[model samples]
Target: MNDNFLNSANAPYVAELFYKYSQEPNSVDSSWRNFFNSLNEDDLSVLGDFGGPEWKKRPSNIIDEISFDKTIRPAPHINIESFKSSTLDSIRALRLIRAYRVNGHLIANLDPLNISKKDYHLELDYKSYGLNDNDLNKEIFIDGSLGLEKAPLKEIIKILKETYSSSIGVEFLHIQSPEQKQWVQERIEEVRNKTIFTPEGKKAIYHRLVESELFEQYLDKKFLGTKRYGIEGGESMIPGIEQIVKQACIAGVENIFIGTAHRGRLTLLSTVLGMPYKSILSKFQGYLNDPNEVLGSGDVKYHLGVSSDREFEGKKIHISLVPNPSHLEAVDPVVMGKVRAKQTQL
Candidate 1:
């Protein structure tokens, strides 16, 4: 190759050729070997003109500088403190919002003996994460009416606690869509701020609570050791479901389908869905009124579902409790399919 090509755009290729020739000169073309030998002699003369020992070190130093410039030296500077603060903020937000998902399982081993309250500090620890009260003063964004603008971090944390740490803790932050997250945030915040329950509403809640307690007491006395799978611990489900049904009716939903396992089904059927007390009691007495109407013997009364068209807030809404087998979560797909069919019909 011509020496001029070494100084042209093909310097890298010539350098590679020289490297190969240095490794095995006999393997290279005779002309190329002669050219390389001439270049090597000229290089030795130049090195001799400059002091040989110092110039010998210069090649290694130049290679080091070239490697540094080409590969290692020009990294963009990052602010370590700012990066740390941002990471802490993300972790804190997850703790405040997403921790409820794991801690708030409906049938968790929270109070196995039903004695003491369960502790849930896995993600709620601030000191463990090197955060203090001073960190709360930093501004952060929440999905609220404020949009992209930030509020004090302390205020956001307070709102999260109030929104999430109630008797019924929620875990909606795992939802992916921004609009859905914002909707949940807005609704939670609304419920938090609108804390006033009307006198009639309070009375209704009390009535449901009393009725639930009385029903459990009656069944305990009448049945005596028979496994009703009673809603003794979860009496609040009665009033809670009433609120849901009321909300659904208010939202102009014409149909509501519920699918749950045996837990709390009897009380829900009788009290909320308006199944007759006599009918439920008749089933408990081992009598099947319409055995031949349905297929394959029958499920237990608790596993059976009831339907009703009820008037809520002066709106007629049809509600169906989809029957579930002894197996948990089996009715979920059945309920969903029914809901999809109803929606398609609508």
Candidate 2:
């Protein structure tokens, strides 16, 4: 709590102590609260001050800020003949009506995955299963006289499906007059093809329906659980991280610094840093355990940073991820500052 203890040498120790004691109600150590509460207004403002690299790129003042338009302006819709008997303005109004009817549209309207092999079925393979491509043939249209989204296409399909489902194992609905319901349902049955997916989709669909692909299939292979938090939704994004990185690197940045936490580090380390999987595993299993190792003490195995250079648009772009405090999102502006500094350097 003293000046000597607040030095760089003791900062890390204090950080850990603050983190640990914070878990207990009475253990928050009063000196920390006293230190924070004692900061002057000037000290506080300096601590929070931020922004301005390309600040010239921002608005000049509060009045210059762009805001969403909240005002509603509506013109009257008058019939042409009814509007015509008055003045020249009325004739103009008639012209407006004629033009509006011709173009304004008194509209009744409605509007409307690659898994890789790890036993991944190519989307092409699911052609026979009616589940995944079933709606492809239908013309999706709707009524809007009552307003928009009167009934979504999916709900309409659901209504039609339930109207006559003795087959495909869809449960039947209970109605007051079954025969009357059956008559309306019979017409729906003629148009609705239950085949939504292709044959391959149907196969995967059935496999899922029957629960055929269980944990036991890999039983012989001896599975250890997967860490599924990220490669995100290429874990089916297709050509994968290379495509993602290539897309992200297009902005005119000389060096890119990213700091995401436990999320994508392993994949990035392997793909970006060329980190050996063996080394990653060693860290995960604590095979590299040495209490005296000081740099990244008490952090998750995947929470370390890496550096590399990539060729973006024929320019060599350097990339590094900063080692962060336990605060994940708090490092975002820090990354921005570093990116701006790199730009200035260029």
Q: How large an RMSD does model 2 have?
A: 29.0
lDDT of 1: 0.60
Reference-based lDDT, each prediction: 0.60, 0.39
Q: List ranges where model 1 is wrong by over 4 Å.
A: 1-160, 164-170, 190-195, 288-298
By summed lDDT, the worst window of 10 consecutive residues in model 2 runs over 49-58
- Indicate the residue-level lDDT of 113 in model 2: 27
TM-score, one value per model: 0.56, 0.32
lDDT of 1 by residue, 154-199 (tens): 7665554555554445566576775676566567667652357899
Report the number of the highest-lDDT candidate.
Answer: 1
Top candidate when judged by TM-score against the true structure: 1
Cα lDDT tens digits for candidate 2, 236-265? 222244445555678655556777765555
Worst 10 contiguous positions by lDDT, candidate 1: 1-10
